[model samples]
Target: MADTITLEVARYRPDRETEPTVEAFEVPLRRDWAVLDGLNHVKDNLDGSLSYRWSCRMGICGSCGMTVNGEPRLTCATFLVDYAPGPVRVEPLANFPVIRDLVVDIGDFMRKLPEVSPWIVRGEGTSVEEGEYLQTPEQLADYSQFSMCINCMLCYSACPVYGLDPEFVGPAAIALAQRYNLDSRDEGADVRMDLLIHPEGIWGCTFVGECTRACPKGVDPAGAIQRYKLTAALQSLKSFVLPRGPR
Candidate 1:
């Protein structure tokens, strides 16, 4: 096994340069060391000026996501030993505006999140004495897969739809909407239906399915969109067949 590996990390200092550049740093190619571990070594020992986002290092935080070898991945979960024998390229997630180096501005995602009404909604809340809303295991399984989303935005990074149209609301937000929509305890699906059924919503998805391929948590945004599309079509059929009352 090689003792060392070269990491070509992307650097972007808006004040320093108009475009991003790569700076290489040789780091120990330890079997236990992840790509993120190499970056930390560079920051702590070689270059203190290096900038990136990381927390929990266990892949739960999802803040350490970056494009490694042109594929979006959790840097902390991708071991350096996997890309042995030479240099590895790491860059900011594609599609989103770069904030600094490996950190891309998530403001776009943040802004679009509320549009889906991600939280559980109800017409009325149960009293404190009534306890929290309860669900059977069967009901829990309905949306459980979507609930695994860590909001990593790797889906957005992998989405060609979002890259073509920034207004498309992206994958994570839509999957989260399904998270609450499928929840039996939540009654907000009606409120979200109009926004989701819009042209800029699920229709924007071309079903490339790269979003699902890129998701670290295994959340299937592409499947959610397809399900929602079927739902909308059924709704349209019902409305056409059964007219409104007293109209």
Candidate 2:
């Protein structure tokens, strides 16, 4: 590998223009450097004007998600060696309003999160002091995969449905809602049903499956949404038959 490389980063100054532009920075990159490290090099040594969001250098924080060479990925886990020979393009996650260089506004995702009501709801004695709610391993497995979302919004960046309808409750948020719904300890499944059946809810997803593919943490948003769809369909059918059934 070369001693250094030129990383082409996409820059968008929302205050200045409606469109995004590209800027390049020559960094002293080693083969072992992660993309976030290269970004820091650009910010610290090469160009102070270059901007991006990052937190924990490890992949857990999920704060440094971006598009590397047109693929949405967590920068902390993506390495420079993967894209050798210089001149790798780095950009903010796509399909969202840009706040500034390499930082897309996450308001849409936040809105969807609220729409899903992502929280555990129980009966009147909701306090933990009441008792420990228990579940079998089989119950945990039902929604275990969906609970791994880090809210990085990379799935939104990969989803075409969000690009088409900004009002749609996105994949990550919906998947999270399903997580709680399937949890044996939580009893708030009926409360979040409206979100699942809304026109701009699960119906918005086109099964593109890009959201799941782009997630670095193996959070399967596509699978979660599909499972929620089936559950909602069965619930709707049951509602027609049982008068006091889950609404």
Candidate 3:
């Protein structure tokens, strides 16, 4: 293995540069060092002006997500050894506005996350005195896989639908909505139906399946979307067969 590896990091300073540029830096290619570590080395030793967002190197925070070799990945978990003996391209995630250098604006996702109401919503409140809403093992299994989302936004970065239409709610948000909708304790499935059933919501997804492939947490957002689509179809059919209010 080479002692050092080259990292071509994308840089964009709106105040200084009109276009984004790539700068190369060499760092020790240790087996233990990840792409984030290399970026830290550059910031610490090479360039102090480099800007990016990262927190909790343990991969729990999910803030270190970036495009490495044209794929969305968590830089904290992606090691340099995997792409050794050459330059690795580290760019800001796709389908988002660049805030500075390696940082991209996630405001779009932030706004859409709440639209689906990815929480257990009930009209009647159960007070603490009423006791916690408990779930059996079978009930917990309903949405456990979808519950693994760390909000990495890699799924968004890889989604072509979102790349084309900015209004698309993307994958993680929809999957999370499904999570709550599947929960036996939640009564707000109807509340989330409108937004998710809209053209730019779950319907926007073409099921390219890249979102699922890009998911590091193994959450099948694509499958979740398909399931939700089927669910919507069934509900629509049932409503048509059995009209509401009075016959």
Candidate 4:
């Protein structure tokens, strides 16, 4: 086995350059090491100036997301052997402003998450008691899948819509909205729908599905977004048949 691995990493020094560029590093590595571990090795031994973000290397924290060889993935979950035989390319996630090497500004992504109001909205007294709000197994199953999102923002990085126009709500936020909409207790879906399924909402998704592919948690954000669209369309059609408001 080779004693060292050569990595072609994208480097950006905001104070020094207007654009990012590629630089190579040769460092010793083990076959059992994850990419995140290798990055630590680079930062520790080969270059102290390398920049990246990471936490909870076990993959639950949703940090350490970056584009490895042009594919967005959690560095904590990606292994070096997966791209063996020599040099690997590491870069920051796409579609966001690069703050530095392997680090992108995610403020817009976070703001979008808040725009969807990603939470349950029950009355104050509902959960004030010690017992939990009643939920059946089926009800839990309905939204439980979508609620697993770790907020890695890899989906946004993989989305072409966001790359083309950052105004688009992107995938994760819409999926989170649907997660609450599917909830048996939440009443905030309507309040959030106008922000979703609008021109800049789910419709903006060309369905390239790269966002779904990039998700590390199997959240299936594309499917969730599509479900939101269908539900919104059906509700719009039903409004015609419903009785008029109380006179």
lDDT, each prediction: 0.92, 0.85, 0.94, 0.88
Question: Clashing residue pairs in candidate 2, if any?
Answer: none
lDDT of 3 by residue, 161-199 (tens): 999999998899999999999999999988898788899
Tens-digit lDDT track for model 4 on 47-159? 89999999899989987999999999899999888787668899999999999998889999888898998988665545455787789999999999899999999999899
lDDT of 2 at 101: 91
Candidate 3 runs further than 4 Å off: 245-247
Best by TM-score: 3
- Which TM-score value belongs to model 1? 0.96
Candidate 2's TM-score: 0.93
Positional deviation of residue 33's Cα in model 2 after best superposition, in angstroms: 0.8
Which segments of candidate 2 are over 4 A away from where they belong?
15-18, 126-130, 242-246
Q: Please report, as a residue range, the 10-residue window in candidate 3 with the lowest summed lDDT.
A: 238-247
Clashes, model 2: 0
Task: Encode model 1's per-residue lDDT on 1-247: one tens digit a residue.
Answer: 9899999999999989999999999999999999999999999999998999999999898899999999999999999999998699999999999989898999999998999999999999889998988899999999999999988899999999899999898899999999999999998987888798888898888899999999988899999988988987788678778878321
> In the order shown, what is each candidate's alpha-carbon RMSD?
1.6, 1.7, 1.5, 2.0
Give the candidate order by descending lDDT.
3, 1, 4, 2
lDDT against true structure, model 1: 0.92
